[model samples]
Target: MELTYKNSKTIDSEQLKNLYNDVGWTAYTKDIELLQQALLQSLEVVSAWDDHNLVGLIRIVGDGLTIIYIQDILVLNEYQNKGIASQLIQDVMSRYESVRQKVLLTEEAPDVRHFYEKQGFQSCDKGDLVSFAKLN
Candidate 1:
């Protein structure tokens, strides 16, 4: 199967939500509103496609110049081990490498780490970070 990756304005929210769920990632539960905002926020985002199907996605949320946080590296289960996700990351990293190349938070998968390591990301135990959550 041929793999294609690209930066897109297309936001197939339902397809993404289903892909996320199939990959055992947390369910966003058809949150089209959030996906709409996310699609708007994604800077230099990359997606993997097999024909008309969206098999994978990687979102970069940050200033175009610096501090790109790589999140939501989702690939459909059937498409795993095909190196599509790696290509997606490479697509994002190539442009940002010259500016700022620090991936703050990753989903922490060994297979994923192996891919990143191949791309030159060393394991770091302690580093700068932050988080906050609010519920009503």
Candidate 2:
């Protein structure tokens, strides 16, 4: 597959819905308008496309100078294991290389941990740091 990557906040709504739905991220797909606005407000958004198909995406948010939060990273199920997600992450990282803190919070799963660890993220406790969240 010839994959093309784009760093743009503008994305077709249908493509965004399809991609989020493909990955079963119902929280995003259930409210496409909110998702789109979130992307517009993000510090950066990197998307992977296979021709007309949106296969992967990585969205980041926060002040670009001191800290950046990795808000989302996803690849279609069929497209996983092919490095698309990694490329998306790399695109964001490279763009914000000077940002002092890069942070992300994801579900606690073995594969998830391994993937982020491989990409140079240490678990919060590893650095004697703790994270808190308030999700409704």
In TM-score terms, candidate 2 sits at 0.96
Per-residue lDDT of candidate 1, residues 31-127 (tens digit): 6567757777777568888888889988878777858877678789888877887777777777787766566456678876777788777766535
The candidate maximizing lDDT is: 2
Give me the runs in candidate 2 sitting further than 4 Å from their true place: none
Estimate every model's Cα lDDT from 0 to 1.
0.73, 0.91
RMSD of 1: 3.2
Worst 10-residue lDDT window, candidate 2: 87-96
Q: Model 2, residue 14: what's the lDDT?
A: 97
